[model samples]
Target: MFYFFSLDFSLVVGIFLFFLFIFFFFLFIYFFFFSKLVIMDWEIMSFNGFDIKFTFLFDWVSLSFVSIVLFISTSVIFFSFYYMMGDVFMFRFIFLVFLFVVSMLVVILVPNLIALLLGWDGLGLVSFCLVIYYQNFKSLVSGMITVLANRVGDVMILLSIGWMVSIGGWNYFFFDNFFCCFWVMFCVCLAGMTKSAQFPFCSWLPAAMAAPTPVSALVHSSTLVTAGVHLILRFWLFLSNYSVVVVFLFFVSSVTMFLSGFSALFETDLKKIIALSTLSQLSVMLFAISNGFCLFGLFHLYTHALFKALLFLCAGTIIHCFSHVQDFRSLGFCWSKIPFVMTFMNFSNLALCGFPFLGGFYSKDLVLESFFFSSWSIFFFLFLFFSTVFTVAYSVRLTLYSMFFMEKGFVVDNESDSEFFVVFPIFLLGLGSIFGGSFFFFLFFVDFSEFLLTSFFLKILIFSFFFWGSLLALWLVFMDFSFDKKVFINYFFYYGSSMWNLQFIFSQFFLNFPFFLSFYYLYKLDRGYLELFGGKGILFVFSWLGNFFHYISFKSVLYFFSFLFFFMIFMFI
Candidate 1:
């Protein structure tokens, strides 16, 4: 028995396995505790003689952003479990949600160009996938167009990378590249414009409403769309060199802000209104980034995520309850039936309107302050002011029309009450919109009071204007401003006239001409080649030559080999 025990190895293996289990159990416990107790430090880790640096630096900027993203994503996932309970493609939805979270985390973590591009592309891919997940042909087409348009901007970024490699070598993809990185900075800003859905590319965002509500919330608010603003903030130092690029960004952002806001004013679809509002709000962030108030931009991004996600989730609940009706004009007196949803949606709309003491007030004030200090152009200030007014106008219009106004022919049947998971996120996000900024200031050692005072009376003046604007819009909407066909026509005429002015002419002549010329050259080349070798000329020549070569080579070689073989055989015989 002793000899048998000595020879047996099974017990030794069992013991080893038991020890391994214990080790893994202890390791799991250690990591769980570490994740709870340890704050991620901003540091550089090196491997294979290459250094990768990142800051888990929970500053005012990163902390605010990361907290908002995680909160919104987690809430949306919680809501999805119930909202998508009976869905066939629930797993696919969750997969995209996880992918979005991972992409956003990567966007916030990596500190260099290559890593940033990785995150950027990842977000874009996830967003495009989510947009077309319903498998509708129209939605898929929109997603394809969005992907292709954004890829054009990505190409600029790739070119910028090559330019950086040429100018500063491979090691200069980090923060240090910004010191003299004007060209790369320009390319990156262009990329940001496309990613954030500014100007001509802004159409895709509104068209993306074919996606489910949760996807719209996640894409527009927290993760993918904000990647552009993240890129700008991550490379703020680089952008400072090209002040003209900053101004260009500002102009594009400002124009898109008002354009989308006004477009939202006319839109009746609940989700499209929200989508347009998102474009406008995102433009505000880009505007902040252009003005060098990156922290302010980040602050706005955090709050916007909270409120916008809340609004979208509430919109989802409404859509689900109303048998998929999405038009604000089609909804009437829903505030009484869906009290919780009404209250939360109002909070979100108010926050978006930049009401005092709300999240938007502070961030909007920061943007106004940045504009005042950077360049005191009256046109810029007025554009900001009018955009704010329009933002208020549309927010009130959406809320009032959807909740209070009674349509003559439309009646809503609210069959389902919003579940706990959906209501909980809305309440939480509303609460955050109220206090998140203050908490961020404390966490990051940021002196909000001083920063608030940095612009002195300008901030107060802007706040007053926003306040009055909201009041005026409220009054006008409540007074039931008649929709005059002539006014719309006149407004269209004004915009058309401005568009056809000098800028339009210049764009057509200088910018568009090159594209036309290239197309013409390609056309000429095709025509010339077709005329020179029309029909079957080249094919016939090639065929004739092939037959000649085949006959000459195969027949001649076979006959010569046969004769030589016969002669050898006869000699042998």
Candidate 2:
């Protein structure tokens, strides 16, 4: 008595086994920590032949990212305790925070595409929940759009998975197949571009600033966007195959970096500016990753997580202190009053601008070096260099205009003191931004004895140039560079006008396009064509003829013949 099973059964069993393994592992880890156990043993858990590993297998790459995610998340949670202390949705917020952490952990731990997709969609769901938690009309609207856009990426990921199965068979979704993987690689890369907010997909990130500052800190800086780059890094071997794809990725990243940096400079809203900067910095990491500098990209992601989260937390502190005023124009010199906040803010901004000796400087220089070595195209190098300059310029503008400079209309209420919880994370992140990269370098990559003796002159040159650029921006802002209003209007109109701008063009060219002939069918009132043949249109005629034949063939003859044959077989058996 043997039983035969279908492929579907095997699929179900495999999924169940994986699901149970993850569930029990999470439960065990939680209980171990909860029971105050100090287990020092490290080992890998295997399911079938695959290693379900834990420990310092969480190496340089994994540790760097995990630390950043957990640190930022912890900070956001701490800040939320203050930011939303008395709010009615405290329990809900905490739940979402935990959900986000769990999803991120799953994402980082899983080495298989199926597991990765589970975590990816789980994170998406959690983020959507966080976004719409307030349940306001604005949040609801933004949440819908954000989820919808993300779903497009999700579908792409699913298609990529299907392609993987079709091409490489079921066994090829793991780390071992990373090399020699092509179709799945391309689809996953496409999904990542959308998820990471590259170019056309970037509109949703800035719009997502509607969420609370703590949510912004966790979602924008530390976790969600970073996941996309993490995915690319996780499968670097696959991506390395298509050098053209890598170059295209670099180009998209460069465009996103410059555009978002410039947009940040022009933004009046504090959160929106930070949001745009997040997009720009993430693009920088993606560019680095695409150029075959996975470690450097991860390093930048780690450092940016710290500094950007601190920046947003500090911004949140200022916003809360000022009764929710977020405009730079309305914020004035508070260097003396909120000295701690200002210090942390300025430090983070300096890090963001890639100041020398800071963590950002090390990671950013590595990114630049990666680009420089990967190509001899001077135009590409120059584009990257100028983008860095613009990064410094906008960061300086943000710090100066908001914290140091005084505007006539700007005022601060005396009651705005930074809370310890909020200030603690800022201080921690500030320290990390100052020292984390060097510390990690020694611990993971090299000893001081093995460190290369590089040209200090180049470092000095780069630092001095950025410092000068920052000063130039400061001087320009102080000088109040003036333009005729008419000139500005002309420039705006000339460059910004597009098909997107013209309603008549959209109606005539897009709406009335003949390929959308079905749309006209909906509006047409004349049933002359239907009435001409008295409901016997082409489809109806075919349907009636088919039915008449079926009644004669199957119902009259075929049905009786099949029934008689089956009855005779049954009787004989």
Model 1 over residues 85-145: C-alpha lDDT tens digits?
Answer: 5566666667677777777777775555665577778877887888898898878866766
Stretches of candidate 2 above 4 Å error? 1-60, 166-180, 407-418, 447-461, 475-573
Give the per-residue lDDT digits (tens) of candidate 2, residues 1-573.
Answer: 011222233234324433543554454445433543222223357677765432212333554466567666666776776677557656667667767877887677555566567778988898889888888988976676577667777887787667666444332235354543666677778788878888767767876777888899888877888888887887777678787778778888988887776566556688988888898899999988887777778878888888888889889888887668888667777676677888888888888888777778778777775664575487776667767877887788777777667643434544445566666667777787788767655544554563334477655756665876687568546544445446664454333222123323422344345536765554452355545455547778889888976776676887667767888999999
Q: TM-score each candidate.
A: 0.73, 0.73
Q: Top model by lDDT, which number?
A: 1
What is the TM-score (0 to 1) of candidate 2?
A: 0.73
229: Cα error in model 2, Å: 0.5
- Model 2 Cα displacement at 551 (Å)? 52
